[model samples]
Target: MSNYQNFPPANEDGAASTQMFRAFVDEPAAQPPTAPNEGRRTGVIALSVIIALVVVAGVVYLAMK
Candidate 1:
């Protein structure tokens, strides 16, 4: 069996092994950063507002006829 599977590698001289361990453990976890959907969201909102206004105007025109 591999030695590291049983125990952490020795840091006998307090140098290389320790640096390697720190580099492995202290490294930040990889993450997929969230992206802002500002443009798409704004376009969707504008389209919804226009659709609502058109529907309201159509209803008003039908009621006035």
Candidate 2:
């Protein structure tokens, strides 16, 4: 009754079209983290840590008031 349970069109022989329709199921991807990208990510992480420390120090100073 629902859309999920709706039957596909039938052929003249009464066979459902769904039998001919194959879902394009993909296999698991294989994109490993590359060294170049990892290097860039490490640089970003280092920069973020430095900026976070600066922000925390500033917040502590402001909160001290």
Candidate 3:
């Protein structure tokens, strides 16, 4: 016998309760709107490019030593 069962109390057979339950279940769930991160992404890309450029310069300087 499976223990995972959800049988709501059979004693709760009121008309008002039934209507309230139906109304609750009929509504769509709300979702938060997503914000664009274009500026942040550009900033991160610029930082990565700067870091890569610095690493290449360091490597060239060491190689010339």
Candidate 4:
């Protein structure tokens, strides 16, 4: 029906296709990277509280039994 439905454009002109390719593939990949520890602090505190509560509950259960 349409040429796009078949082989499509191969970017033979190299300008619009290269721009499209870089826009979808390369540009977003060029984002500034974040530190491994950037957003881990809050999660660590919440997890620590959960772990501590479980530990305390276990200790109390053992003492009562």
Sliding window of 10 residues with minimal summed lDDT for model 1: 6-15
Q: What is the lDDT of residue 60 in candidate 2?
A: 100
Of 2 and 4, the candidate ranking higher by TM-score? 2
Instruction: Output candidate 4 Cα RMSD.
Output: 11.7
lDDT digits (tens) for residues 4-57 of candidate 2: 675545644345354344332344567976676877899999999999999999
lDDT by residue for model 4 (20-56), tens: 7767886544668777885798789999999999999
True-structure lDDT of candidate 2: 0.72
What are the C-alpha RMSDs, in order, of all predicted structures?
Answer: 8.3, 13.9, 12.3, 11.7
Q: Which residue pairs in candidate 2 have backbone atoms (N, alpha carbon, C) closer than 3 angstroms, thus clashing? A: none
Query: Where does candidate 2 have its weakest 10-residue lDDT segment?
Result: 18-27
The Cα local distance difference test for each model comes to: 0.84, 0.72, 0.87, 0.78
Between the candidate structures 1 and 2, which one is better when assessed by TM-score? Answer: 1
Off by over 4 Å in 2: 1-34
Q: Against the hidden reference, what TM-scores do the models get? A: 0.47, 0.44, 0.46, 0.42
Residue 43 C-alpha lDDT in model 4: 88
Ranking by TM-score: 1, 3, 2, 4
TM-score of 1: 0.47
Clash tally for model 4: 0
lDDT by residue for model 1 (1-65), tens: 65665543564544467678889999999998776898899999999999999999999999999
Candidate 3 regions with alpha-carbon error over 4 angstroms: 1-35
Q: Give the Å shift of residue 59 in candidate 2.
A: 0.4
